[model samples]
Target: MSLATLWALGSVGDRLRVAYRLLSKDLDMQIETTAVIRNVQKGTASGDLTTHGLEFDQLDPAQQMAMKAFVFDRQDDALEWSHGAR
Candidate 1:
């Protein structure tokens, strides 16, 4: 299936799963990718993923949604990597 289709149809977890699967060819790639995702998830949960050390909760709702989309897209990009892209 195409990524756009998956992105349109899948939930966040599903997208992450597909991303990880695509990265599975390289152990380091998988580890690093998942680590970043985990950190973002942690920040989302605890409100700490800010450049100014402000809690994520302190951000306006639009900023919060932007952050989530940024993190999610980063994970999605993992699915597009090639050996040279690594």
Candidate 2:
């Protein structure tokens, strides 16, 4: 998703912990990841995520965008963890 989408979703003030599945177009592989909102600034929202046992920033750009788009689009109705349970 775009920065505009993140803003519309009120990401600046809300802590959104998200999980998403991403399929690599080239590798034909699927990855599941989890991210926790860290901060938002200058029209950009950023967070820490672990995918395939690697930090989000360590992943390729395509993987990063895929995760961001997936989470941003679903944050509104997304479920949250409650006392360690969803």
lDDT of 2 by residue, 1-86 (tens): 12223233334334333334443332333444433333444333364322121133244577666666656545532543233344
The estimated TM-scores of all candidates read 0.30, 0.28
Candidate 1 minimal-lDDT segment of 10 residues: 30-39
Range of the 10 consecutive residues with the lowest summed lDDT in candidate 2 = 48-57
Estimate the TM-score for candidate 2.
0.28
Give the per-residue lDDT of model 1 (tens digit) for 1-86. Answer: 22222113323333233332212222223211121111122223344432211122144455445555656666666756643364
User: Model 1 residue 83 lDDT?
Assistant: 38
C-alpha lDDT values of all predictions: 0.33, 0.40
Model 1 RMSD, rounded to 1 decimal: 16.5
Q: How accurate is candidate 1 locally (lDDT)?
A: 0.33
